[model samples]
Structure formats: structure tokens, C-alpha cells
Target: MTDAPFQFFDVEVLRTERLTPAVARVVLGGASVSRMASAGRDQRVKLFLPHPGQREPVLPDTERADWYDAYRELDPAVRGVMRTYTVRELRGEAGELVIDFALHGDEAPAGAAGATAHDTGADVHGDAGTASGPATRWARAAGPGDRISVLAPVQEENGGYDFRPPEGTDWVLLTGDESALPAVAGILESLPPGLPTRVWIEVHDPADRQDLPTKADAEIVWLVHGTSPTTTEAIRAAELPAGTPYAWTAGEAATVKALRRHLVGERGFDRRAVKFSGYWRRGASEDSPMSAADAEEEA
Candidate 1:
């Protein structure tokens, strides 16, 4: 591992599965995966994918102190395609890491047959839309034995996640779209039993709803994009548990912002008590330039 807070790990896809209509799960395995440690809830990692026609990603030299600067200097078209994703589960015993991708952009046909590990370069069917991003394309086409690289934490106490509930908190609130499902699931799994927890998840399709298993006394409500009320609307209408509440919300930038404002401004929640993140904006790709305000929210 490098001497930095994050280390680069080369991995191969051990397997992949379509979890839901909008979510795909990739199980990655490599000798290096055994040494990687995650802080669990909402742990973020930088995934580097090879460009089309390349077998593996071209990454910056790990020995360098300023690896990110070196990466930025490389040719964009040839260098690795980097995107941030959550570590859904880290199974050290199995030497594997799991990541779930929310299918977006131009997607493969609903009935299309996915290629197997042996068929590495099969043509995928779908309409090519301007909104399609490399990450979305890569996830849809990824197969077993496919190569990728990740920048992950080597320590358990790494501050790469943001699901801390302060002491004296009586209840918890979690909300997000499919983009934030992995994080919400992780948080739910980590909560103590009998803790009063409320969740509001929004997804484009009802089939995207996941069976989130948690030990906590959690009340989860799924909101289909066109069929159900918005997260803010659901939260506003429901009666919340008494006492100090810790809230975590993520998804589209505008939706996250609206939820945060409602919690802090209208509901009288302490600004610091609510941990929110904008996983993506409605029409913008991750490569889009972020404004100062967006950077602040992400930070």
C-alpha cells in the first residue's frame, strides 16, 4: 500500500449481478482486497475504469507523493475514468469488495442478455443518449475477469464516510434516491437494535425497491418517482419521533438541498445535526464543473 491515506488496489471482477431494475452489483476480488479496510456506512472509494479498447486502467504512479496531480496531467482520453462510489460491503475473509451501481444515462435494453465472463467484448444494445456517461456504460457492460482499480482506505477509522449520529440522539432519519441506496443500507445495517429510525427512499421504478435488512426498529418507506410523494412531502406529512434526530439524506442535488432546508429551516433541526450529500444532479454528469456551493456541500 502507498503511504497516503488512500491506496490504489488493482482488482478484477469476481462476479456481477443485476440486483434490481436500476441497480447492478459487482463483486470484486484480488489479493489486495484482503488488506483493504472500510469504515462501513457510506464509505466512498474512487473507482478507475479502463477506457474502451484498453485492458486495464492507466493510473498514476503510486510511489509519487502527489499522485492526483500526476493523474490530472495525464491524457484524459487514455488515462483511467475515475468515478466515486460507495463500498457496499467489504468481505475481508472472502477477499472481496462489493459495489452497487445505480443504472443511469443510456441503459441497456430491459430484456437484453448480459455477456458472460468469457465474452468480454459483446455488443450491448441501447439508445446512445447525450446524458450517458462512461461509468454508466462501464457498469452495464462489466463482466467477470474485467480489470479495474480503486483508491480505498487502509484503516477502519478513515473519515471517508458521513453517517455519524451524535451522542444523545434519540432517533435517526435517512433519505435518498437509488444513488444513495448502498449508503442507506449500510447505515441501516449498522444501527443499534430498537433504535427508532425512519427512512424515505425514492426510485424511478417500483422494482428498484430493496429489502433493506436492519436490526433497528426502522420504518422504511419507498417512494416511486412518478407514483408516490416526494421525500420532502412524505417527511413533512408524517409525525416524527420525539427527541433529537440525526438525519442523513443524499441523491439529486436539488432534492437533497430541498430536504436539508426543510429539516433545518422548517423543522428546526440543527444544521450540524443533518448530514446530507448530493450524489448527482438531475441533468449533469459527474464530470461537470461543480460550483463553490456544490464543493462545500460535498466537503
Candidate 2:
């Protein structure tokens, strides 16, 4: 499959807001962004940055129709590595878009690379150590007038899984890591009023817990993973209330898989009823985000 020609659009940074110590919200607006505000909440688009002294990158005009497929099919070796991030909120009337980024600390590879670059007084992109790491670095400095190339939105395949609570289902179980929080929050917000839901989120620390606005009857549990994302023991210790009929889990690759197997295979939940996804695999780089196909094969 071949990719469509690139559609170049210019967006201005309208404002930037800090959500937390680690999370930043960037708002962009422009006539070119009108269509994106109507896209789904979880939809993702690629952001291409202009290299030093280069105008915005260009795509062929004819490739626009099949851009998503062509973009995905492009040779990894030739294309600049793209980072996948969520579209947290969109406002068409206001011509606004919001994306959240998790700040990297010293322990994180991105943070460490940034630190090293600062010490050496090197250009951000020239610092090979940081440039070769995760996408977090890009988020740290992203601002308006940055001239980023954006691909059309691509929907997540696993989003079709049944998250709607059944008529008789009295309780819901939601579990995931920070990567899955956006989806979890969306799911909770969509549930019908008075539907009891329990959410368990694994974050790096207590400060990671953000108030999620939801109308559904729910309880939130946060598990901290200081210094690493593999600290799933607290997540494992969670005991769902008796008679939980629905379960949705997403997080690190290995952890989510294990939870799915345990709930469906060992606990005897219907295999078709549980929706689980691995947002990212441990040790996997952002340039190659995990896909549902990979998750299925691994499972």
C-alpha cells in the first residue's frame, strides 16, 4: 500500500495550560484544524516537526485519500519516527484542541537524555542521546508556531470491545495504567447514571491521580509505581466486589495480558465479555507503538 500525498496545515498555539506538575495541556487553533475538533476523543494523529532551517515537510497531493494506510505502511527506516498521543479534548466552535503530556523525571530515559543535553549545552535535536529516546522529549518543549506535520486520525481497533454495562450487570471493573487513564476516564463518563463502576489505575505516584468527572456510580483506586512501571503488585491485590459482571483492563503489555487471562481463564468470566488492551509494552520504544495485532499474537 502506498501513502497519499501529505496535506499541510498550519496551526497556531492558542494557549498552553499546566494540568499538574507533570502534565501540560496545549491548545491549538487555525482554520486547518477545524476538521480535527470533530474527531473522536481517543483518535490519534501523527505530528511531524520541521527540522532546523527546513520548511514544513510536504506529502504528495495524490496520497491524501489513503494517507492513513500509506502513512502506516511507510518504511520505518526512511520516515521520521512518529509518536502516538491521545486527543484528550476537542472543541470545534472554539477552534481548540487539547493534548496532555506526562513530564519525564530523571529516571525516565527521555528526562535523562534532556539532562545530559543541558549539561553539554547541545541543541535539543542534535543531542543524539535524547533524540533517540522516547517521545516525551518532544512533548516537553512543544509550543505554538512549531509547524508540525499532522496525519489524519486513526481509530484504536480495540475501542469496539463492549464497555456498555449489560442490563443485569450491577458492577463494573476498570483497571489500567496511566497510559490507559484517558480511555478509562472516557468510559466512566459515558456510563449510564447510577451504574456502579470501580476503577483501578496504576500511576507513578499518588500525585498522578487526577479527578475524573463521571456521572456513573464509581469508586477509583490508584496504585503508585515509583521509579518504574512494573510495580503491578498493588494492582494485582485489588479484589473486585462480588458479582462483577463486566471488566475492562488496559495497561503495560505483560500486565494487561496476565490480568485478562486470570479474569477470563481462571476466574471463569466469559472470554467474550472482557475487554483488555496493552497500551504499551515494557521496554518498547514510542516510535513503534504496540498494536492490537501484537497483543493478540502475544496472548
Candidate 3:
């Protein structure tokens, strides 16, 4: 499965740590992760989380091309929730994979553009896994030694990764809401120390702003919920740096579209040079039945 685009790997929770008030880091270990050569920045993996009660989720047959269709055929009640997540960090040497989850607990504020944020991204339980989202709720409660399934990209052709800034760009603009933070952090870590960048990250609370490691000449801007503007609005109003600027933006579907329009339509930025993704839509949960193609951006 070295070069296979799709592969299933069983991973066990080795440990967990709280990264911020509304975020937790879970480390998983497995042989497959150790041998993985290069996980592109912003790599997207599908997680098969255990449903409400059952542990040791029923495994799926991933060898066939119709794996997803077959998965859809399973009994809805027994079929676990499949959510997409960004790989926050992958330590190939230690066989550890880190994933940062944006906790949407009961007290967490509502999301942007009418997203599923609750009470300013704070959970009344003061812990993860109490949000309305099944993934968040589960992640908050997940612990060490627990088990789950992951369908990861194998660094093959046309992989599921998202980070791909065009070649020869003078500077970069990285902006997104919390959902995009994991990928944004991965991208920042992989960047060269010399590249200049303007980064805008919006979170519900200041505590949600985790340490972002980057050596690039980054003018980092942190946006707090009540005091700051929306991610799209702030980024749209920002002045782009001199020279050819490549922009990568993500977050709510509506917000992403608005930002893209401002960059290309209003600012006259080249469409092909801008990259964007809709991590989620307004009023939609992580498992919302949204068409993947719905996220349109500059080609």
C-alpha cells in the first residue's frame, strides 16, 4: 500500500493533550504511520468514529473501488460516523500522528456565517466532546488507548491533500477560521523560513489560539470572537503584499466564497493563483450531507 492512493490503517490512541480551551490534541500510533514517507501539508484523512455505544467499530472492506458505496449500504445505526480531519502533525520517526480537534462543546460559540457555533465556542462542561457535533463530542471524550479507523492518503497521484501554492509566488496570504487551523499550521510548519506571509486566524476565544510554529516572515494576526470581525471580512479588507501574492483560504463555505470573490473579483487577483476550500458550510455539522464539489474556488 506504499503508493496506493487509498488505504485503511488501524490506529490506537497513544495519548492526548489539551492544546487550548476549545482544542485537544490526540496522538495515534501505528506501523503504517511510521512508514509513511511524506504527508503533504494539509493532508485530509477520513476518520471512522465509533457510534454512540459500540466500541471497536466494524471494519470495512477497503480493497474494492466501491468502498464508500459499500459503506453506505451498511445499517445506518451500526455504521459509524465518517468525518474528514486534517493531520496536524505526523512524526514518522515515532510512529505518531497528531490531530487537533476544534471542540464545539455546549458552550462553544456559534460558527461563522451562521455556522454551528454555540455560545462563543465555549462548552459548559469546560471540556471537549460536549458540542452538538458528533465528531467534536466524541473527540472531547476520546482518551488514550482507545481505537478508531483512519483512511489516509498514501502520497500517490492526485492525493487528498490540500496545500498547494503555485510555484514562483512572491508572498502568501493564509487565512481561515478554526476549522482550517490544523491545515494552516501544517502548511506554516512546512514553509521555508524566508518566505513572507500574512496570516489571519480567527477563533472564538484568545485561548483557542495555539502556538503556530513558522519561520516565514509572517505578520500574524489573531482575531478574537467578540472583538474581531469575521474571517472573510477581515481578510477581504487586508492589503495584499507587494509582488505576486498567492492566497490560501478556508473555513465556512459561504465565507470562503466571499473571500475568493473579494480576492479575484474585486482585488483582481489572478483566479488561478488563489486556492480555497470550504471546510464546512454555515449551519452544517461536520457530517452534513454536502456535495464535495460544492466548494468552488479559483482554478
Candidate 4:
């Protein structure tokens, strides 16, 4: 196999499930899926979704290094919709991959396409059309046999896997909003057994809370929207474990910066020991130019 860091693969939706009030799980399976590998924690993948009328996403030649540029040159309405998402799990033996999507505040409308054959009745919580982006809408209405494309790593050591707790680390600190749940879950599941860990997750509703099974001795806190404090505030006010620590934070760009600032400035954490990412920024679409949070995280 080629040693490229990432490659494109065409996959089809094998099934879909409602994991929580705001999260939908889509299982994709195809011949190409067997060749994909994930490094687990916070493994990033770029997914290409077809427009409503398109049979499959229209992508540029995958072999070209500048395929992204080629894709950008295409007419927006004629090109595929792209989104970044974390893989919840990879079932290699079964040739399947799972991705969990946050539905935001919208649910699939009744009588939508393929509702009868593959609808799991999972998109039942929020009103349709509220805060629903292309990905959200696609997830809401996605069904078995729906086709898509993904650019993912075939090897585990690719730069896409970012959560790395160095040796000698005594404990871990994790914070994120709903978007980071899958990454956090993957990290928790893969942590060394009996390690000290703390997690704070913010979600739109109590029903969005997921049962994350992990071997680490973890204390998890769920911060609900409007009821609980923001992720930064919650982590800031709490006392953390006394030891060499490694922290990872993701979610809204601004909030992620706040958490990183608090950890490094107020909490006296080594800047390098705290890894952060902004999965998204408020008031911005996924396709928008990088924001300050993106620069801050890189810094």
C-alpha cells in the first residue's frame, strides 16, 4: 500500500442510529473501508456529502495533491459539501466505520426520503431547520445505501490523530462540547487503566449525555446548555488533580481559547502539555476562513 498520509474512499451508509437527543450515529461500510485505519483519539476525517439531488459527492481527482484546490475551483452548487468529523469507532473486520453527528437543534422532518426504510426515529428531539447545516440536514435525512466520500488515513501515525499524552504524565484533563464527545470517548476508552482522569462535556440537553465506557478512573461532568456553566467556567472553578498533567480541549473556538488560557495562565500548566483545537467557531460556517481560534490553537 502507498505510504500516503491520507487517501479518499467511497463509502455507503449501512445503517443509522440515534445515540442521544442531539447525536446521530451513522455506520458506513464498503470495500474501501477495510483499508482505512484510525489512530483512535481525536482522529480527524474529511467527509464529502452529495447535494440533495446528486447520487454521490462530486470530488476532484484523489491522486492529485492539489485536489482540494481543484474542488474549490468547481461551482459551489455543483460540488460536494465537505465537513470534518471524528470517527466514533472503526469496525475493521466488518468493513465499517461509525461517525456520530450532533444534530444541533433540528430533527429529520417526517416523510423525508428513505424515512420508511432506514429511519431509526432518532431525530425526534428538536424542531426541523433550527441550526441545521448541510451536514446536520444530511445526517437527519441520511439512510441506508446513501453514498458519500471520505479522506482518511490508512496508517495510524498520520497527523490526523492529535491527542497525545506524553510519558510520565500522571493524569489527564479533557474538556469539550458535544462536538468533541466522540474524541473524548475514544481517548477515555484508550487511556491506561486506572489512570486519573477528569472530563467536562457540554451538551444541548441532558439526553445528549452518553455512557462512555472506559477503564481509567475518570470523573465525568456533563454541563447542559442554559442549566450548567460554560465549559471554561466549569473547568476554571474546579480544583484539579495534583500531578503532572496533560490536557486536551476542543469545541467552540472562543471557549477553547478560554480553556487553554486558564490552563496555562491561571492553572500553571505547561503550554506544551495542553493540546487544544477549535472544532468550530460561533457565527461561522465550516467553509469559512480560519478564525483567531485556529491561529491561537496552532500557536
Instruction: Assess candidate 3 and give its lDDT.
Output: 0.70
Candidate 4, residues 1-299: lDDT per residue as tens digits? 24587999999999999987667899999998989989998888888889889989998887887888899899888898777788889998899999988775434332222111111221111111234667777888899999999989998788887799999999999988777888999999999899999999987667678999999999999997667898888987898999999999876666778889889999999998998886665444445454324534543
lDDT of 1 by residue, 1-299 (tens): 45566888999999999998667899999998988999898898888889999999998896688887899889988999777788999999999999987665445334222211002211111111234457667888999999999989999888788899999999999998776888999999999999999999987777778999999999999997767998999999999999999999876666788889899999999998999876665333334455323633652
94, model 4: CA deviation in Å? 0.5
Candidate 4 ranges beyond 4 A from true positions: 108-130, 291-299
Q: Rank the candidates by lDDT, best first.
A: 1, 4, 3, 2
Lowest summed lDDT window (length 10), candidate 1: 116-125
- Candidate-wise lDDT, in order: 0.77, 0.54, 0.70, 0.77
lDDT of 3 at 55: 76
Clashing residue pairs in candidate 2 (N, C-alpha, C atoms within 3 angstroms) = 3-70, 4-63, 5-60, 5-63, 5-64, 6-59, 6-60
With candidate 2 superimposed using the best TM-score fit, by how many Å does residue 49's alpha carbon deviate from the native? 4.5
> Between the candidate structures 1 and 2, which one is better when assessed by lDDT?
1
User: Model 1 clash pairs?
Assistant: none
Predicted structure 2: lDDT: 0.54
Each model's TM-score, in the order given? Answer: 0.90, 0.72, 0.87, 0.89
TM-score of 4: 0.89
Off by over 4 Å in 1: 108-130, 291-299
**Residue pairs with backbone atoms closer than 3 Å in model 4 (clashes):** none
TM-score of 3: 0.87
| Per-residue lDDT over 1-299 for candidate 2, one digit per residue giving the tens place of the 0 to 100 score | 13222233456567777665545567767776655422342344445544334344333342467654665665554444454455666676776766665454433432333221221122111111223233345445657665555554322332333354556776787887655655676677667797777777766556667888888888887765555434235435656666747877765667777877777766777776677665555434444343545644453
Give the Å error, residue 134, model 4. Answer: 0.4
